[model samples]
Target: MEERNRSASLRRALTVLDHVRAHPGLTLTQLAEAVGLSKSTVLRLTAPLIEAGLLDRDRDSGLYRLGHGALRLGQAYLDTLDLRAVAAEESHRLMAEVGETVHLVVPDHPHVVYIDKVENEASVRMASRIGSRGPVHCTAVGKAILAWQPAELLTGLVLEPRTRHTITDVERLRAELAQIRRRGYAVDDRENEPEVRCVAAPIFDHQDAVAAAVSVSGLTSRITAARVRELGPLVAAAAARISSKLGSTTR
Candidate 1:
């Protein structure tokens, strides 16, 4: 009975906080009505939240609002989130839907580092490993992320040739990046590896900056140009989901 009462009190306190967060500057009476509690009970509930710095009450206006404690808690959650773990579900789903290997990579300035890979039993195994690095100029995942980055970053990039299809010309690569931004995805038609093809999309962070990219990779025999067009939107949608999970408001 004692424990049950404590749990109820905790729930009530949290409810009060939620109400204030949704309707900031709410008066004591308004908050009570919102949470379906009496004025006195709401006041008692808010006492703890106010003391803990999760809420603030305006002395002159008797209005309630969220406090710095809420910001700190939100920041703590964002800081603890791991990019690989956040993108894991979408990466696996993309691989399952496409029947190809999926890779998750993060920007490493002039390159992208593979941080995770997902594939099924019959999926074509990619040469990429979790810790391996690929040039930003030649890999689909790399180009996907670079497309959203600051334009100045492109000026300093060295467009080295990886294969005959690789875009070694800076002007052409710039045009390719523009196309990627317009289409919401990027494609590597045997540019990184002569026999491999890939389609990738950028992942955004809370600030709407490109934080990473997700890609579907397979042999040229399986992932042809037509197939890339089909997989482009699928990969982009998967990356958008991952970005949403990371607190991105805009995809």
Candidate 2:
């Protein structure tokens, strides 16, 4: 009986939350009617949620709505939706077009983490490991996201140097990001690894926020300065195509 009551309570809580999410700012009475629960039961259920910050009630208007805690939980769920699997076809197409290794990366604060890759036929392969972190200040994948982060977060990064050419100065990095924004792409320019270069472009979600990025990387011996210029637009195109598939209405 105790276990059955607990399960019923949990189901009720979830149903109440789902109702609140679907109809934001509903009153206590409105929620009770929507979920077919008694007003007293809703009061009991919402008390714990209000304490946990998952739900909030407006004292002035006497309405209930999801809070910051709920938003965090929703975002966590969205983050786990396999972006690599979502981007697989686009990554393969890009690999075929550029003949270089392609990476799918997401920002991990001070680093960018590789979630997936499409490898090239070349014998000299990129040293990147899937699920490994790379510096945000120098890697093309990192630069692409850095260029899209909020100004306060972008300015506060430590800009740790990985190579001689790595942009350690805030002003220099800001300038580089400006160029990236204008061109819709970013480049490593041998900053992450000796004799290696890469071009990358941001992938935006339906909210028009940079969610992740796609990068084309190769040995600098074959991926020359001229080749970088050529592949830059192609990378941006691939990223845009992937973003569209991910529900971005942006062209």
Identify the leading candidate in terms of TM-score: 1
Residue-by-residue lDDT tens digits, candidate 2, 60-179: 998998988987876776677667877999999999987999999998988889999889876477888899999888999998998988867665688776778788888888899999
**Per-residue lDDT over 142-251 for candidate 1, one digit per residue giving the tens place of the 0 to 100 score:** 99998998889988788888899999988999999999999999999999899999999999997888999999999999998899999999999999999999988766
**Candidate 2 residue spans exceeding 4 A from truth:** 1-81
RMSD of 2: 8.9
> After superposition, which runs of candidate 1 have C-alpha atoms over 4 Å from their true positions?
1-52, 57-65
lDDT (C-alpha, whole model) for all candidates: 0.91, 0.88
lDDT of 1 at 240: 95
User: What residue pairs are clashing in model 2?
Assistant: none
Clashing pairs in 1: none
